[model samples]
Target: MNTWCVAAPLCLSVQSYADGNLTLENKGEDGKGKCPFDPFQRYASVMFENKLYSATSMNFLGSEPVLMRSSPVSIRTEFKSSWLNEPNFVSMAHMSESVMSASGDDDKVYLFFSETAVECDCYNKLLVSRVARVCKGDVGGQRTLQKKWTSFLKARIDCPVLESQLPYIIQDTYRWCDPQQPWKDCLFFAVFTPQSDTSDLSAVCVYLVSDISKVFAEGKYKTPVPVETSFVKWVMYSGDVPFPRPGACIDNSARKAGITQTLDLPDRTLQFIKDKPLMDHAIQPIGEAPLLVRRGAKFTRIIVNQVQAADGEKYHVMFIGTEEGTMLKAVNYNGEMFIIEEVQLFQPPHPIKILKFSNVTRQLYAGSDYGAAQIPLATCGRSSSCMDCVLARDPYCGWDTVGGKCIVISNSQRELIQSVKEGDASLCPGADPVKPVNQSIWLGGNVKLSCPSASNLGKTTWEQDSSPLTLSTHLQLLQDGLLIFNASHSDTGVYRCLSVERSKAGEYTTTLAEYHVSIPEGGDDRNVISPEAQINGPSLAGLQVVVGLLLVSLLALLAWNFYKGHLPLPWNYRKKNREQSQETPDQEGLNSCTTYQDAQRPALAEDKPLVSGIDNGSRNNNHTRGAAAFSAAEENDDSTFTPPSLQYIDDESEM
Candidate 1:
């Protein structure tokens, strides 16, 4: 092992901004120290025993990757082995810790990285990924590796290939840490993509902490022959190795106290680690296929979170980031990967290159070169209504009855999962149910029907007239329950958002929304309102009838009062029928054929009178002429009375 001095962060200037609880830290000035090493571009950092352990690299494309401890206090120590300087570190974790106890189990940091090497002469120079361990207390051997690592040992991380003996390339890794199983059971999942263009496939593999330890303990190794040719000179070892594994951490009860350092140890243990670093077996993914794969959208980083729901059960939640700035929240369900949601964390092309999750605070930190953002892991406040909370189906958040709000489930909630699934909504009493929306669009225009459902377990669907909707050339149904496309008259219907869930009681469907989508018959571009600015429905027909009658009564009363200028209504209100009889001269003016139509003074004459025989006798010569003159005059002007002059004419005719 060779020693290399590490640069400090004193020269590194930090630029930061604080908004509420979120703090964004951006790299300011160059931080290289007098040691002539560049500042780290990225790091695989972890918290162990209240301290941060990081496998960091500077000018990663150029050189110099080292392991360091920071935070709580900066720059506690730095270790730079000769083998480590060229490696590209990808992931790091605290393997074991023993600061609390004096019995001395071990405190170790495990780092995973890839390096280019011509190892053992068995294989030509090639790039390989490895898992390296170092004792936390190791200062170095006095002579061989001063200020360098003594317990430094690395092994190949063999990712098995389907058709080739060569290992697949390790692209990324995520740690699955369980607080319930501290030292015994921690595991890692690695993403491996094949080098073959024909296959062009990737897979996720799981490696147990116990399995990794066993490989270093009992596996055989390859060592170079002493007088070997340059090529193909390495063979399996046949000699006795050192006592107590060389990779194990140096501790009080570990070796004889007199030895004190790695220099006095036998050669077998050190060479064994060097020869055989690859694990004996390769761990496969949970399912038949990889966790996820796509021809486009390369994955950038993955972090695993364990969730303890109200039901006192746990879940594995994976937040995977992509190069396109999309973060997919997924879950492992019965060996299948279910993408619950996809959130665009930033503007396109601004990828979230780094992600850190705090289990204690339930917060997620996402960072890019420009800035870092912090958001809560559980968005309890986002569930504004009870229906929204239930639909979200988030295990960490539930409706709090006493607070009348959606809040993170407290420790006392043992049946949080069960409570949410009952669908009673009694947990959030008095909250208004979500209302269905009515939408109207113009013919040949665009229409988007949104049906919101929060539960990931439910299968969301759209139905028209109780029949399932099918995607047509122009009509599309999206996973988020949005039915959108060009609107037409044929699209007028009641669209229902139905969620079907399969349970022990068989399949049940719940209708989330009933959208009445209508195309306006009024048909004009000017009449078309943007979705955001659409007007409300017209007033009720009953209200219009009441208003019309009130306006009519008002006008009729005004006309009556206008006719009687001298007379006034009671309390100055218009009085009804206050006019006297009309004057004879004014009556004569209106007596002509037009106005005399209402004058029916001779109306009695038209009846079959008691004097029906008198008219027959009028045929006699005495009064026939006079009576006939008068009757003729009456017939011509039946609306007015005949004058006395007509009577005299009748007397003269009789004489």
Candidate 2:
């Protein structure tokens, strides 16, 4: 027996290994300790600079956003809080999707959230949407009280509104790296508005904010900024517009009467609206604000628009998740939009508060009402085929276009064949067959080849040339990994059983077992013997000749009988009668006498009794005689019966 082994490819990895099994790595559970206030609501955690940072409020009721930083390995270690009150509102309530970005000399941890006032009264009038900044150094400390977070700057304007009739609010905030300006920071935030008049008019608006620091330093806050900022609108659909309901809640009475108008708008914007210099102290009118998204439209609700790298030159991609559970992905290319992919991450109508991206591993993590989920950006990077991207294992790596290389991030086991065996014989290196078997067997005979029985070991195939043999009809796979081939010339070949294994050093080892098969010459000729040759063999020739002569004599006698018409009784009777008529006058006169008697009997029956008792008795006797005669005739007929001689001939011919 000869042995062969084939190794499995090393591209496979155990993304997640547990209890002697492996699975692809998916989103993990929240690691923070359970809070008594709200056990259902858990804060999101991220690993940055080897430290785990978690964002939470001081109390469940408080809106102050605070960060707790600690080593990921030590969960109980002290966590430091970072943030300070700013010129504007400094309240934070469960900060949505926080991410860190380093620009120039400053490393900024950008926190995206829709600013909310704890007081319901203030919340209704003032909705602050902001991107908070924290330096990298603040998160490195281990003390909670020592760490201080400061609000660097806030958006100059509020979220846009539509018609002032519908209830519109900022739903969630998503931060992504700008594709066009990869080196510079870009943010995409989604605003969700509810439709008051129609259910279909709800909408989501996406605003692209770039170089947030410039917006703060330029005093855009003092300007009368456009209520409808440079934002893209996704509207909710209503079957019809010009809403029919005109109730106070459905009507724009307060806004139309200028009840909530003010001059505390952005400086640049107030100059344009009022045509004169105005004091920054005056409050701006909410009705004058532009609508980000139309109310009651189809695609309404908070949703992630695009998650991408800050610098467009990098291959960084981001995915944004909305309150409605829809995910949108965007790629940055030299100041232009490259690609935008959308995925539904959650069931519809649920709220989502935050969306963040991890720069180190390029995984997009989302936070919503149901829970949090992380999707690898590389998995969604496929251009034409989605399978190749989604099936990728490594989170840190991506598909390289130039080198045609797929980067591997994690170290895991690769599948390998363990061993090959034949019955009790091991086909591996040590315990194989003592002799090289090159035996040949005729077609329709069983040929057995065995391999070791192991889970990792895959099935083996018998190849004639390079093609696999048809194993269904002519081949059987035994439970012991023995390949049994039924008799067939196609089984003639150098059959090989190959096994492959991956070593701890990441190299593949192969072993092979081979056997040479040929058709036995004598066996073929023995099975193909002709019928004539068998009959003419030395022991039977005399007997066959004797039987043949006897058959010929019988056939000649039958043919003579048929030619003489002796085999047909009717023809023979007619000939006999013709011979007698010409030769015997007494026989001819007897025939005439019988014919005359038959004609005289019919005339005598007409004179028989019509009412005599003796005649009736005679009639009954005649009826009995007639029944007997019919029975005898029926018994004499043989049409339904088969003769033994004909059955015997049929049986002999069939044999």
Candidate 3:
């Protein structure tokens, strides 16, 4: 139901809808059947003074790339391989150069992109990050270039980390400038990735506008030369340079020489620029190296913000977006890049497509294919402890002693403690007491003590009784805890897990966990000691009463048995023994005359075997009995012997 306009590439076509109806429609540029911009290929565009300037492919197949002005109708870059070779445009910046230019040069529009490197020789294709500039006042030449730009020139943006590690693929770039200063003092920050997939390193490099201008204006040009039968190579041209330079803008110096425009330039100058548009000197970064180099993340977008800390020193904080929908906040402290923290901006992690920072709101706007998110630049209230807040070293957060919490620092704030560089927790007014958990374990048993890591940058270690824990066969350190195998009494002590984070200022130690480990005594190896049983002891009077009751029951049973005449008393048993000894051998049979005293005698180790020889001797040496006894002894010698019993009483009178 809303009115809309579609700007297509076919003759700068426009389709307007008003009141749910198509009111106007047109096609092609210059009112002719010619396409000025390709609708299929991705492109980069910028608006300057109500005029649209775009760098995009001109054809459907995206083979022919060009940088064209929309209002001028087909005024674009010349279709030459030297100008742009398979360039994939990323973004564009349009700023005035009148503030710092001494030559009174025209304003310029800079384009950032990655294209196939024609100057480098390799087995496969090599793409390099480039920054190309074109004067805003360029209106094409009269006869030489016709409708093509005469000031179009590009140079490599150098972001070298080491001699061999070169991140040449530019993923994204952002232009940052101080609001109180002129636009000429702006700096361009670019995110570069390595061309090879062997390393996933991403680097952020900053380029000064002056360095880029010098390379285009004063650098040498590379010219093509024949090498072999059909091979040609582009090398640096070391010959007499043409006047006014090939890629210099039409400035006051050109006006003094009676050449006020590109049309006034001779045919020699246009032909020279057509063959050599690439600069020999690459634009190095501010420090001749990358501002930050991270190995595990591939940065997709970046935004920089200038912040004033509590110390009154200004720092530029860079928020870099990764391919995994995470934002990394980093800053260069004393020439060293330190990553403050990483925030996950999306769930189920989509790649971050765009990033925009608002200086007024102090918020970061991130967008992806799924949706967009608005995240605050700092979340200071998440820190629960002063030590944690201080060790974070976040410039936006400070420990508020009066409020007993961490709060955000602003220009108008006061009476807050912050040490962004040192991360010294000693500056804190007071620290929370560390309470140790008491654990009672059995001897010769295994136990694992847990410890949490305070920070990802810190190293965890176990300390015993205020000294470094020594490793032995029984002690083992794990990722999150310590294991004691077959724990002994020697392993019992106070254990503290300390996390130490090292920085340039100093090292900070924080106690993650404290434990008081003790092994209870008086326990067998097979049984665990019971705490309840150890707390309660047995009563001595109870044991004595139970023993007396058992003794009385035995005496009453013995008396009842004697009264019933089933069991003989001690005197009766002695009288029976005497009567048995007084009886003659003829009065009783051999087996019936045996006494109970002989049967009750205990056996001894050295006792001899019982035989019929004693009975034979008692029978007055009878010949028949003696002959039978001799035969029995001979038969018993082949069989097993039964030894006689020998009993010895300690006190015969008591028995």
Candidate 4:
């Protein structure tokens, strides 16, 4: 355990715990401190032979990076830009390769990180992921490069990056050693991402331990030189190399020449290594490319587990964690990457900070800022049927015919059905029946039928009543499901979503979703235009219905006002009546008017027909007189109306 003062961020105290008690490790009896290493930077460390090997900064400011060994014999790399240039340490692993070495070599510790490139010429700084190695037997030099690693060498990882050519920064690494296999045959897996902020592309790459060793032993060295009017260039050195190799570990061949330890070596050898620690050749992945490259994901951490399947072949299953708090279970089959499944690890997602796996417990533990999660290595029970279990291509899971369930594969069980390469589930007892979802959609309504896709490699196709579903203006296929713009009677049928995947064996089809759609004979008289349609634009039928309803409403309002005696007569009829009344009337005309008024007034109380006839005759006379007066006024005016002609022009000059 350690304690730090909040007020003084630089003041740190280290302690050790044993027998339920804590003892200070860096405090002296005289009330002073003796700590040699800083623990605040993003660093990597490993324990080998009761000693700590770490790649960390030397001071509190973290400007000077170093790879060091602690305790009994304190040793580290020289403070040089060529050796370690602003390196951000990622992870470390201690591999015991001495057991299988015929040259009596010592085990080595490997460091994975990204640092400013020393071999590149650019206007701006270029970062590159590197794999550096140091022998456990390296003590230090005597004269030239004392108290520094003699076997230190680093090389760039040659895996492909994003299309934008962004640097693939190494985030985390895991060393996978196959059980009962030699250390040289083991593999090192690293997770890489292109710029933590700008790019979401991430990749998982596997490098054989043997391949990394080859580059350090046989690859050429890179020397930095200044060019004319340009940045310094790092070119391959084609000169004579020193005897016994510069960066090679002190093996039996060196002991034969009376030089074993790095301290006994001549200053010339140490000087060559210190000046040029970089290799010219880059280390390629297992397939000369990344095993998996995901465009929309950022892989934070990864752990690998090699399992023996029922087919008697061992395969590597990788459990990778992403920045979105999701875990992806993926495996490579026949050089093709297959993502088995993805599961959410945290709610209100946060980036995964740590990932660890225990072979004894067979559980994977993941940690984030908010909380931690424990997941099983194999989720066989989640695969409900034989076809699903087999098609999953998971080396850890198999379908048991007798038990009728998917179970974790074991050497003891031989009857389990699994196909890791071919993905042929034909050996199963029977096929799982497809359960169709019943859907009742109203006529002229929109519907969205969903088809869940399991893997990105699979292709989805739609079928209606065993015939291919053709896409039209009303029907469209989406990434995750199918959409119907406006359903009709012809759209009612059995729809199925089938997913097809190609493999080495052949193509396999699986039903992802099924729907039984039906429309009743006589449906409710509901509005045909849905809210979605209204947002898009109204149809012709909908517009016509709206116009008809508006016309009926206007007529009803007028009739209601007239019945209540609130409606008035037309202004033209009223004005014409007043003008005629103001004019002089002959005796005969006045007599006729008086006689008509007397007849209508007496019969209005008992005879409705006679009163209506008199009122209609008077209205017809007023309409005829108004038309004649308007015609006479137009004839008297000089600015009278004329029909338009092709040759007519408003301006006489233009004409």
**236-260: candidate 1 lDDT, tens digit per residue:** 5566756656656655555555555
Tens digits of per-residue lDDT for model 4, 1-655: 8996432123234477789987765543321111224433577888788887877776656777888887567788888889999988899998897896899888989999999998877778888999999988888889877788888999998668646475688889899987688988889999988864666778998899999999998999999888897667899999999977898999898999999798888888888998999999999889788999987668999999888888888888999999899999998887888888889999888988889987688789999989999999888887777777888888988888777889988733557888888888776666766799998676777789999864445689999999999999999999888998778889999999998777566777889899998875453357543445556566767889999999999999999987786886588569967777776555335544445545644444343212121233343244343334334534654333332223322343321
Q: For each candidate, C-alpha RMSD in Å?
A: 26.4, 25.9, 20.6, 14.5
Best by lDDT: 4
Better of 2 and 3 by TM-score: 3
The segments of candidate 4 whose C-alpha lies over 4 angstroms from its true place after superposition are 1-41, 161-167, 195-200, 226-232, 411-414, 432-463, 468-491, 495-504, 508-655
**Worst 10-residue lDDT window, candidate 2:** 416-425
**Model 1 lDDT-worst window of ten:** 604-613
Model 3 residue pairs with clashes: 10-28, 11-28, 11-29
Could you tell me the lDDT of residue 611 within candidate 2?
A: 20
lDDT of 3 by residue, 1-655 (tens): 9985645454333477678876445443442113334443457888798777888876656788888876754578888777888988888998788656778888889999999888876667778888998888777777888777878888888789673454468888899888788775689999988888777788999988878888887888888888775666889999887777777789998899999888787777777887888888889999798999998768999998887777878888899999889999998887879888888998888889889987688788999889899988888877777877887788888888878888888732566787787777788766776899997777676778998756646788989999999999899998889999877778889999998887666887888899999876554356654443445555346667889999999999999999999998899999988887887664443324233223423331122222233443433334454345434533563333232333443443312
Better of 1 and 2 by TM-score: 1
Q: Model 1 — TM-score against the truth?
A: 0.57
Cand. 3 Cα-lDDT: 0.77
- lDDT (10s digit) by residue, model 2, range 1-655: 9895632212233487789988854544433331213444434345556555555444444344444544432222122111222112212222122233321123444444443322123324344444444434332212321122221223323444544453444444444444455434454444444424344343333333433434432322222232365422222222221111110011133234442222111233222212211112211212333223332223322323232221112343434444466655443333333223456676654544556556687566766656777776544224211112212211323333333333322311232111111111121123233243585665555666654432132234445444555657556766554455556666677665544323222323223345677776764665654333455566367778999999999999888988897686677789977787785665565555445445644554343222222223344344443334334434554423221121221222222
Worst 10 residues of 4 by lDDT: 27-36
Candidate models: Cα lDDT each:
0.58, 0.38, 0.77, 0.80
Q: Ranking by TM-score, best first?
A: 4, 3, 1, 2
Error of 1 at 46 (Å): 6.8
